[model samples]
Target: MVPCEDYLVSMIDLPDDSLHIIFHKLESCTDRNAFGLTCWRWLQIQNLARGSLQFKCSHRSSISDNVRYLSRLLGRFQQLNSISLAGCTELPDSALTQLRSSGSNLRTLFLDCCFGITDNGLSLVFAGCPALVSVSLYRCNVTDVGLEILAKSCPTLERVNLSYCTLLSDHGIGALSRECLKLRAMTISYCRGITGTGFRGCSPTLAYLEADSCLLTPDGLLGAVSGGGLQYLNVSSLRCWAGGDGLASIGAGFAKNLCFLNLRLCRFVGNESVGTIAKGCPVLEEWNLALCHEVRVSGWEAIGSNCHNLKVLHVNRCRNLCDHGLRALQDGCHQLAVLYMHGCRRVTWVGLESFRMRRWGVKVRGEENVSVGPSLDQFFL
Candidate 1:
């Protein structure tokens, strides 16, 4: 009889197409590694099949060795298109420099919380990687100088995330917006230095923008929204209020395509501006107005009547919300699927029960903080 090992290998061998399909089905890097080590056939399949690589560290460690290891792996995996180096707090600049020579076909690169990368290192990396399409430097040491270099180097760049990069001012962002015409998505949340003037006549293709917890005034935000292609916008916790008119301008410009809007913790925004948004953005699907104490039934009624496409509504911690508002929502917004109304003190069980009975299919989630305190009455039979 033939050797058992040889027979097993022959029997288990899969065609190239079948092996490729199996490799495509595998998502976990650990699984891919195990599959590759199974046999010589699988090793060859893994080499050809691998396209994206991610290095995520949940705990802090010296990633200098890991980066060197990645450089060596890049030689083996020539088809790599994306790489993520997130949570590697101790990663040095020199490691990124090595990546430039190895990652030639790289399209996407994420350097989240890699605090060690300064302007010099990033400049070197960007100089080598011209094919990069998406780049994220979330909480990195990258400054205006770094961004300016990136703008000049990477022309095909589209999506960029610069969240919590404290040193970057409008000068860097302005340069980037002007240089990278193909740029669309931007997440610059917690970037206090960025003023509205930086985004004047910026990318016409820009769709998603998030600048929450920034020092942007209503005028600054309004300028950014004027791009006329914004579909999703979040300017929550703005340093100052520019009144309802600023938001009204945004609504007018983006009414046709705007779908998701988050104005949570925007204490200064009142019913007037929100009402305007509701009327203008008729196709709105999701809205978050949490802690907006000023909004009453009038705003809810407007949203309910005009925003028929609205599916998810978050009015959590709105102490002013009452039965009238809930009833208004029931009258309109038939497509509503999820509702969050925690800390709606004025809403009694009777009103909630009635609304629940009306839209029995909608998932209503929240805990009522009845001033009457915890008692047997809290439970509705």
Candidate 2:
């Protein structure tokens, strides 16, 4: 057998393709870095094998370091697919311009909390990267013009998160719906300007939609999702305008396959609306009705008997909930694995304890102490 030094030398001389196969086996970033540091040959091979990179610019030193490293990687790796610059506060538009100049066929890009990325810089991104499939601009300064440019440029975009993009309005959303036919999941939470018109007459290819805290009226929702197979829907906090009638419309028309629904803080939602949901969504598995005070014991009874597939229920801060409601859930929802009832004033220790003692009881953290049962965080864990 050869000596240890000779074996080391032979390993370093392995073909580029073989080295790339070995790199794929290294799961952790630290392990890959260590392997790259073994020798110059391995480092070159490692760079070639790389497909994703994340840069966080916290301090001045990190910013400079990231710039230099990114420049080198962009020059070397043409196969880069994913890049995240989340929380890179100091990163300027110039850096983004440079990244786009690399002409990488980027599939996923996250610029969340990158405060420096303006419309001009983002315009450069959309213009340069047409192959982009997923893009997030959470808390960025991107406006309607940038969105318009994005819609016209990237036709293949599937997922987009414009959460907290306060400047974007219905015009931008309408453009996206009209142009990006392949778009699947969209998160427009806190974008108040987005009304139902954006989705009107557009294709119903969207499966996931999170439009929480928006101005989407019930009719607008009906018009927007008329044809799609929407599975996950979060229209929570619609100023209570989309009440039972609105929910009923959704259940009857758009969301037959709906599994997850979050109507948290929808103050207008009562037993009538929830009853509609029970009858409409037969496959519903998770429901979040936190702070929906109008839903009483009758709603719980309806859910228990009708929504048999529901495995997770969050009814926190529902002031009207009492012992009767808990009993309804206990009797009907046999598949329930998680239940949250914190801030439910009428549900006392006695009612909660009896359920915990039974075989069907979920036995979540707060089950041990009937009076002050578990907090909301415990159920989530």
Candidate 3:
């Protein structure tokens, strides 16, 4: 393992004012105990800093009262900008409720995957967090009524990720979209209750949208105003947009300037849409074309020829990709950092009768050339 000194030496000599900025990036992100005990300087970094204080618990730890406890601990640094107590099964409502009035500077909050969280628990955040800008509630049980209250209360909300909150319907979306003109990013994945009507009314300035596993239709995907800026989109696993031409419409209308595109598991992405995306999105960077059963191997070649800036390519469970397509990506997309090609059964390097070479692929029972593909990370999930 690399030493902390080595890592510290790699970074530029940060000033006192900028140290807080750097500390904000590390204090909540880096290993907590290790970062706290690094040195007196490292320990003091967050003391004077005033940005965000995240108290997330991955395990089944009970920290309801602890949230307020930490606020008291950091009473002097009142410039706290955000707080996230995710997965704290025993987190008390009283402790969190008081933070609304106390942590006045907080702008963002993420309570993802907390099974124990209820409507009343979130109501505290909605009522308290007046200046909130972003919120993520993945796998949490925040219903439409609670979300409706949140939309009505928090006016500064811009980015929201409510993936897996299946109960939130058009009523919730309707209420929120009424005021959030500055909203940029949102994720309603697996929220089958919301459709095109819900989205069109809510987000006029939406740029980043991820609605995977939802019931959003083609009209819903096109709900954004023509002039409205919709850049990054990920709308995979929709049963409504399953036709070949429907996928093409998405390429022609919505995906023109999409920088990040993840259309994995979309039942209708074939050569037509693939070809259109390669031609449309010149500045495309990250792309996930995994589980697209209908997409032909030639589509990747077109993408390689067009999107030169392509970095991450995921082709998981695409059983149709052959050596021809794989070689095209290998030779064309030089900037690809990760390539996921797991479950692509047709992609093999077996000597097809006459073809012979010393650098044959690794001996795998099922996949003839599994070893010949990209790294394992590039190959699968």
Candidate 4:
């Protein structure tokens, strides 16, 4: 048998191709770092094998030092195809210019909360990264010109998130919708400037959208759902002139593929809107109606009769929801697994106990430790 030293030497003598295969199998950074530290050859191979880099700088670090360090890392990791500088608030436009060297290989870029990156920086970086497929710029200082540049430069983009990018308007969104033909998922939440008119030219490949707190209109809402392929949508707190009419139109037009919806804090949603959703969205599995006090007995009855596949429901603070509405749900939604009824003052203890007796498996939440005495007429059914 050979000595232990000889065996170690033989293991290290493996070909570079064989070592590259082993290096990629290492899922932990610690293990990969240890492998790289084994020798100079191993370190060079590890750098070449590295495809993704995530650099986060602490607030205590000097901005110049952070930029210098990141520039060195970009120079060293020449094969990197994905880069995430999320929450690196101090990074300026000059730091992104370092990307010019490796931009051709990059496919994913995330610069969330990097306030210093403006339209100029975006124009500088995107002109080089032609193969980019996914980009997220949450809370960035980018405006319509920057977005227009991105749309025109990267035709292969498939997923983008511009949430809280306050400077973005309908013009930017319109450019993105018209240019990015392969885009599938987009999040524009809290973009108050967008009135949803840009979505009229949205790509048919787009299926998932989250535009909560946007200033939407009936025509805009109609254009978004008319595609008949949307599966996930969240328009909570949508600011519209007549929200009830917009919601009713959504139920009437795009009821085919919807699976998840969040309508929380929509003050104008009334019985007609809820009833229409119940009848239209038959495959609906989850619905949030919290703080919607306008829904009465008729709306609850409609939900119970239709939404058979419903598994989760939130009706918190529904003042008009009493024993009648509770009974309708308990009798109909057999697939119900979770229910939230925290502030239903009109629902008495008797009704709650009766519903619990019928559906003991369901998780009833937000109604703990409350006294509902028989003498109290306020809580009486």
Candidate 5:
């Protein structure tokens, strides 16, 4: 009685189908769930855009019953393109098997950090989602045989991330190199056993690669980066015995068209490598050379001078740098919005305070830099 008419007037009269379209645009699954429970029409959002599905069994709010209910609700819609079962430990094998056999047109899948999933459970996805373009299997205990089957079957795959997957090694990577040709990106980070030889002859169209901790040498890794038109690369924690020549190969092969490059902890690269990169990649924006022990001020100066459009740079923990390097960065890289100079003891507050006063937008976010100290030998070096 107290303004029921006023509330009704505020609500716009739209068709049920129109309301469904508005809710489907939201990327947040939580918001989607809330909207679905709002009204009967919103609950039927699957009829419009069942593009991305996330089966999160870890969250108590979206329990096992909720997943089952969702499967039933989505059973009618056969056009789902992406499915993310990040933490569904309680999800039965039968449920996944049934979903796959239903002829659902799923293409992208993310099974990040899901523990209950075994090889048997994963096999269902390969047989079902034959048109899959991207797959992320982080923290899963996938073995070589399972990987072979997936690589052989999923020929249309564009990207695959196997980060922190302990069981995977050169065996799986070699198998993939032989079979999968459509892959554009692959991440084998924390796979300690895989050497450089296993990554050869992969996709030529590969644009993104993240092999942070693999023992890939310059030549073996260069095969994947050189021939391909790569745009993003992260080869952190790599140890190359090829010396200056190896690091030079990185700049020679990969720098062109590369937007984001991370050579973190690749301890062998020196000033020569930096010079090559500056000459090769002019449009490079974001770079992380953190802990690359051999980098010097000359290298930093070359980067700053050449990569004028660079926005983000991280040289954290490189002891070779002095105030000269920081000054060069400030002088050349006018567009630099963020800088990480932690562990560079030679870099006094002179250069840092200058940028701090101007508020060079060097504010940190996402993660803190805790390694603030450098050895006594660092300043003298």
Candidate 6:
């Protein structure tokens, strides 16, 4: 009789294409690694199929050794298109220089909390990865010089996240906006040095922006919105009341396309600005005005009157939002679907029940302080 082992069909006997399909189907890293260990042929197929690689520093190993190991892996994965290195605190210029030899296919690079790499290292690495399209340097020690070099090197860049990169300023932003015409999405949240001036004549192709907590001025805000193509904007926690005009400018310039707007934590935003946005942004769908205590009846009425497309509205913690505001929203905002009013102390159960009676299909979510003392019904009456 033939040996029993002869009856077993080896997965290695499958065609290379079939093996590649199997490798792609394995979503977990652990499963992929196990698949590669099946045989040398399977390992080669796994390496060829892999396009993205991520590395995190091992606390048990020395930094230098980890970098050396990383360099070796980079060489082995010559087909890699995306590379992410997180918490590589002491990663040196020489470590990234290895990409110069094997990063011809690299298109995406993400470095988070990699404090040691600077402009020189960036210049060297970008020179090799000229086709890079998306680069995120969160909390990296990079400045305007580095950004300028990146802009010039990779003109095809589309998405960039420089959040928490404190060293960058408007000069770097200007260079990027001028050079990368195809740029679409950018996040500069917590970047205090960027006052929005860098976006003076930025590409109209740019649409999504997150500038929360930045030191934004009126002129800077105008520059950002002047492109007239912004679809999503987040300017939360902006303290400069003068920039309120800039917020209103979004409705003027991006009226045709702006869909999502977040003005959360803007404590000083008054009725005038809110009214302007409501009158102009007819297509505005989702708006977050949480923590905006100054917006009263007029602002809410304007929103209900003009923002017919408003679907999701967040007025959480708005101390001044009373029965009238709720009634106006229920009456005019016909498309209103989801309403969040958490911590709204002034809205009584009677007003809320009245709103629910009218807009029974709408989902209202909140924790109003109704039982603290005498109800706010007397004030509304």
Better of 2 and 4 by TM-score: 4
Poorest stretch of ten by lDDT in candidate 4: 371-380
* Residue lDDT tens for model 2, 283-366: 888888888888898888999899888887888878998989888988887788888767788989998887777735574432
Regarding TM-score, does 5 or 6 come out ahead? 6
lDDT of each: 0.78, 0.78, 0.66, 0.83, 0.70, 0.83
lDDT of 3: 0.66
Across 1-381, the per-residue lDDT of candidate 1 in tens digits comes to 877776565525668898888888998878977988888888878886767778664344446556667667766666778878887777778777656754568888889999877899898889988888889999998999999999998988888999999998888988888999888888899998887667877877877788888887666776687777777777777765645435666666554677777777877666677788888887788788888888888878887888889888888888778999889998899889988789889888999999999999889976432111112112111
TM-score of 4: 0.88
**Model 4, residue pairs in steric clash:** none
Q: By TM-score, highest first, what's the ranking?
A: 4, 6, 2, 1, 5, 3
Better of 1 and 2 by TM-score: 2
Off by over 4 Å in 5: 1-49, 58-79, 90-95, 102-104, 174-180, 239-245, 350-381
Which residue pairs in candidate 3 have backbone atoms (N, alpha carbon, C) closer than 3 angstroms, thus clashing? 64-91, 64-92, 81-106, 177-202, 339-378, 340-378, 340-379, 341-379, 342-379
Candidate 5: minimum summed lDDT over ten consecutive residues — where?
371-380
By TM-score, the best candidate is 4
Residue 264 error, candidate 1, Å: 1.0
- The regions of model 4 sitting more than 4 angstroms off are 1-13, 58-61, 243-245, 367-381
Worst 10 residues of 1 by lDDT: 372-381
Which residue runs of candidate 3 sit more than 4 Å off their true CA positions? 1-51, 55-78, 113-121, 201-205, 224-228, 239-245, 297-305, 323-381
* Residue 238 accuracy (lDDT) in model 1: 75
TM-score, predicted candidate 6 vs. hidden true structure: 0.87
Q: Which lDDT tens digits does candidate 4 get at residues 24-120? A: 8998979988998989999999999889999998677899999999999999999889999999987899999989777779998999999988899
